[model samples]
Target: MRSRRGALSEVYDLLRSEIIAGVFDPGAQLVELVLAEKYGTSRTPIREALRRLEQDGLVERGERGLRVRTRSPEEILEIYEVRIYLEAMAASTAAQRRSDFDLIRIRRAQETMDDTSTDDPAAMAAANRAVHETIWAASHNGTVVDLLTRLNNHLTRYPATTLKTPGRWPEALQEHWAMIDAIEQRDSARAHDLARDHMTKARELRLELYRADPSA
Candidate 1:
């Protein structure tokens, strides 16, 4: 039972990573037999892992079988509505409470995002996540961090990075610099406002993308 449980967990993490990375695109079927062969496991463990994923709200039941959940534009907008306020509040807290180490980590993550040369959305997206995670860590509010992290898991279903949207990253990077400056200056209001603007732009871009292809 222990060994089986371990295998189940391993499968769960692997599949979750791929799903988040867009390896399995949104709305893609998670065919058990296919996944079983790919993972070199039987259906039992795959099924168990998928069950856990459903509980995590990463996947849902489809007509034929299990598939990745697809979010409508309105659902996504609702998510960002909550995220904008929560994230901005977190940024405010982080500015007020951040230590030197917190500042260092945030700077490193910002640098990481700015330094990415490859057009690989996954790498940029991961780096972008690091910056926000650093801020959340600095916030010192475990409840907010936990809530944002869970919301983020649902957001990872996006097949592309908002940073990669044409004419977005450069402006977004500039916004990050401003936000960082506000944090470093311990200007909580500025940090909050900048964070809110950043999310509002992101919400617009994501809405455009969804409108372009609602099924995507």
Candidate 2:
């Protein structure tokens, strides 16, 4: 006994997941008539679902109506590489400059993240941001923190955080644990290396995803 609202919600989730996974491909038009047929619904629900996607930044309306937004893989890579260097420096500085209280805050952030389900992207993204921001604070560099925050916002143009990718959560969690240990031990080099490796691995996985779906 699914209500119309329930069906519309389901359709929205289905379309959102597909779009993020690149199933719809960038710039692919989402025609109301085609979607209505595909989801076995009226144009009303289809429109509702599309409006949600548009609001989410997963779609855009032009002269041709709604199309999946084009994601520039090159820009994604460039942004990531920049983050890698900044994160490596931040982690190293954090290891050198952090107090016990700073470390405790970072530990708390990761614990919160671990307690949340990976299926919830918003929660994971929020936790992830908190954890990183804490580390940046520990670095005691306002300039770097401000720059990284801006860079992170640009990343939303891509799919959500890589934390929710299949099999990535556990690996990422372990990496975070190791990073915490390195920073706690005041091993600046180790912390820097771990941070770089973590970002590098994520970059590789994300590039593969972009390569597989060459619609844009």
Candidate 3:
């Protein structure tokens, strides 16, 4: 009962979600025929979906056609560095210009993410993304929001299992609270410092986990 356009859109969303949740592992080839069968759609929609993912940096074309991009330790570090600067800028701007409504929305996101104490990588990743998106939305900067969206897409390639570690969830929740408090108080400097520190800590944690992993 769906139009061709709607079918294509659904295929795209399905593929995007699978890639983001690590269902498609790094370097795994995306065979159009396989995906088309899996999604119960035609190859045309599958190709369109892959093309969209390529534009989002989630997939790349190789001699084998499309494959999920891999994340190296160095690349993860670079991403964190960029995120630190951009997130800090967003937090600082949000602190300076946030209205009561914005603060309330941020606080709600913080509350929603507060109870994210689970070993489920997918759930934690979703909650973490919600927190960041809420904070970025408070900034009211279109360009920064667009940049963060791209950065987040790249970051989804990283092994999010790091956040599922025993104590990391609590630490991350506390950091989110600190950021919320800074924004609520209109403390631009504090918000910027906190945002940078939060991302730096996450980078350190991920690096340590990567070092400990034999497969990394």
Top model number, lDDT: 1
Candidate 1 local lDDT, residue 73: 83
Pairs clashing within candidate 3: none
lDDT of 2 by residue, 25-127 (tens): 7789999999889888889888999987776667888778899877777867888889999998899999999999999999999999889877788788778
Q: lDDT: which is higher, 1 or 2? A: 1
Give the 10-residue window scoring lowest on summed lDDT in candidate 3: 157-166
For each predicted model, how many residue pairs clash, with residues at least 3 apart or on different chains? 0, 0, 0
- Runs of candidate 2 with Cα error greater than 4 angstroms are 1-70, 213-216
- Local distance difference test values of all predictions, in order: 0.88, 0.84, 0.85
**Model 1 residue 38 distance off true place after TM-score fit, in angstroms:** 4.9
In candidate 2, how many Å is residue 183 off? 0.8
Error of 2 at 174 (Å): 0.4
**Alpha-carbon lDDT of model 2:** 0.84
Residue-level lDDT for 75 in candidate 1: 78
Q: Any residue pairs clashing in model 2, and if so which? A: none
Over all chains combined, what TM-score does candidate 2 have? 0.66
**Where in model 3 is the C-alpha error above 4 Å?**
119-121, 214-216
lDDT of 3 by residue, 139-174 (tens): 999899999899888876665556776687888888
Measured against the true structure, the TM-scores of the candidates, in listed sequence, are 0.86, 0.66, 0.88
lDDT of 3: 0.85
